[model samples]
Target: MHAKFEIFAAVAPGLELALRDEALERGFRKAKAAPGGVRFRGTWADVWRANLELRGASKVLARIGQFRVTHLAQLDKLARDFDWTRVMRPDVPVRVEVTCKRSKIYHEGAAAERIERALAEELGAPIDPDAQVVVKARIEDDTCTLSVDTSGELLHKRGHKVAVGKAPMRENMAALFLRQCGFDGQEPVLDPMCGSGTFVIEAAEMAMGLQAGRSRGFAFEQLATFDSNAFDALKSPAEPADLAWNFYGSDRNAGAIEMSAANADRASVGAVTHFRHCGTSEAERPQGPSGLVIVNPPYGGRIGDKKALYALYDALGRTLKQRFKGWRVGIITNEASLAKATGLRFKPTSAPVAHGGIKVTLYQTDAIT
Candidate 1:
């Protein structure tokens, strides 16, 4: 195996800064921001740690090596010479994906064929169109860079949340948003419009110091360089702390509440998360110390008609303003008008974040008076 290599932690667009901070805090060496992700360098151990701990990344890619190629002949020659045995297993199958940009050899299909043939013929490894392990080949500016998708499944699949609501928030995005809201796991969290209890469950897990990847398996485990014993050691996190305060969630849909409770139970945070069926106007402040109230309410143009959402936002604003004193709020919405309808005085906004296809921004507030 290579002594050191470059690893890219892929995060959602507009969340590179948050992922960078998470990487640095996790003690990844020289974590720096790139356009779509954070780049760091480490050995295979660092790759395993990143897959297990980083919460903001959707997937992790390890840059095995790169070479400049002007033609398929050069690519074939180089692909055969590279030490594939160091990373890929002869017994397992791999899927190769190629993308070409601004290069003479712009035919991605032909390029992928040549590379796949080289791997199959020279390394004695099988090529399966559907495989858990992926090898990504990008030929940009005449440079052919090969990287392995160390994260087989997406990082957000924590393996516990089997049920999700329509337009549910991803676990990774929820973790980053909680961090953006200055949540240190010390404050209680409330999600008034909790769909599947994503915010409440994530907050409970964070407060308990749970590892994000504790319940799932990763693609890196199939790599040749993967150390099973070392990985087992890394998987042993400290015991989950006993939280004194509980997280709360309420939604108008009974199905959503049932789904939230079931998901929380599967996640092992059911004791600390309470889910109830109620509308935004009927959501009362739970009995607990004032903390953070974060919600991603429905927006028009995607899930509902825009014309009918104003009253919903207005009721949410009125409820928080009149009942939730001393609490801070983070509202995620694509339309500023909807946010303004809440009538909650928001501080200056942060950068717009991309959720699904819509671009949403987080509007935060100081302590509610």
Candidate 2:
């Protein structure tokens, strides 16, 4: 039987091209992009490696089944007919989220009700609205497709950052932003306002050839037919030779520095990055030459403190220009005007990342020529 899997990638909204390239590099030949997700076909091995190595993906889901239905009756039948036992654990509580768009199954409540009923009847698991296993329904153009949320929570909940202080960016988002800045292991990386050290930690981890999934578990393990032996064999080896720590991080807040040190220690990435405390204006470039510098500073958009943030971005821009020449830069935020204050040539790639209810884009700039 040809195994069908859903490999989801983090896209930069208008920059689907970037995401496409990442998918192709992962041995996914027929990669196609959709709104908020990507659909691709691969084998069990592909699924394992994609989950293990693909940095751009937020989650890798196996499309257990999909059906087209026009009426409520068909929706009920489809959910009941799916081999739920093959994928979902009977003991685990599950949640259903439904979306309707240009379809006859227009009632969201009815759709959720039908599926929830099927799962309860078949599995005898009570429906907890905030359960671990989530079943998603999408109705578009008279077709209703059902997918099990394989990675229960986002993959960025990478299990290590228990001491997440300040505004911590997701690991999945940090990885994509690093790729957006052309990180190829050949360049030095830096995050000036490295709160909780997400960017720096991700960079250091990648540089050390560490598996992102090694530190955490996924929803797939709870499902039936999840081969523990297959998955365990894919994990990167723990023992490795010493490598260079080209990634660096700094923050002005003393508490942030302390928190980052602890977070990085838990993450086992102290060998990959150097953490320091310094204001953006007084921050110094690394000892090496040109590399990428990324920062996900607070925009004050969600909290209504944009004025003080403007000063911070201003100081950051001057630091990059004065210390690091011909170095690529990336800034993730919801505020475009705040990013424009940096005075660097920014390519506004609309990032489909929602942090603290703030959907934003990463404004990146090329090296000064």
Candidate 3:
């Protein structure tokens, strides 16, 4: 492999700008926003650091190579010439996935099969249908781009917090939303409808400068070019910064509260996080600096009747406006009407975000007066 290559850090569709900003801030000088992801140029260590540190990216893919191919014969020839030994191991099993768009090689299965045969015949690598290491081939505009999935599992897994609620906010989404709210980990955060405590736990982890992948393994560890010692250095845990109980979450369901608390405990953020059983109406500001209040409430269509949720949104808006003065708020929900029901004047909204299978938007308010 070349000493440097293009790295694509995939994120939630609506969060492309956020991830790009995050990468730039983290010193990825070449980071730029692209469709569905942020792209940067860096060495192998950069890939490892991205997987370890980026909280907003879903996965980090290293672009191995790309070429223009108009026919299956050209693809097969290029695949055979591609240097698979640079990234893939002959012993480690890998899966190949191909996507073709606006290209002459329109058959995805045929493209994948050609690449698989090349890897097996040239590199002597075993192909597994269910392997963690994935080689992705994308044929777009007659250009074939081959990349490796360095992040085995979705970043949100985090390997801690196995407990989840019906509509739990993903940790990656929570981190980006927190960034959108201008959270710097110096203030307290509250989630009145906290599901599985994603926001609170992520906030605590951020405050302590904890590496997001510290508790998990990565697919890069199984690759041929992987440096265990150098990667281990990256995994060296940072000292947890001294912090108080500034992160808090609450839910009306006892089961959800239990899950939140357990998740927090498993994440090792319990010391700085507190989970309680309370509805939005009962949520109160903690006795300290006011911070962000972010929530991903049920979309009503899935959890309850749309008509019934208006009252819930109204009560939530009223509670925050009445009590959470000087604090900012971010609401992620599908319906603009539902967000408007809050009666909280939000700043200009952004494009809708795809959460689960539904489209949601982040409604932010200037510091509540």
Best candidate per lDDT, number?
Answer: 1
- What order do you get sorting by lDDT, best first? 1, 3, 2
Model 2 lDDT, residue 15, Cα: 43
- The digit string of per-residue lDDT tens for model 3 on 62-176 reads 9989999999999999999998887889999989999999999999999999999999999998999999999999999999999999999999889998888887778898899
TM-score of 1: 0.97
Tens-digit lDDT track of model 1 for 94-131: 98999999998988988998889888988888999988
* True lDDT of residue 16, candidate 3: 96
Model 1 clash pairs are none
Q: Candidate 3 — which pairs collide? A: none
lDDT score for candidate 1 against the true structure: 0.91
Tens-place lDDT per residue, model 2, 1-369, is 246666555443544555566678767888887765566877655666666676666777666667889999988888888778877778888899899999988999999999999999977778998887788888888787777666766777777887776567878768877876788666678899888888888887777777777777777777675788888887878555276437888998888888888888787887667888888887787776778889987787664498878888888888888888888899887878888888888875754566667777788888855
Give the Cα error of residue 82 in candidate 1, in Å: 1.3
Q: Tell how far residue 8 is off in model 1, in angstroms.
A: 0.5
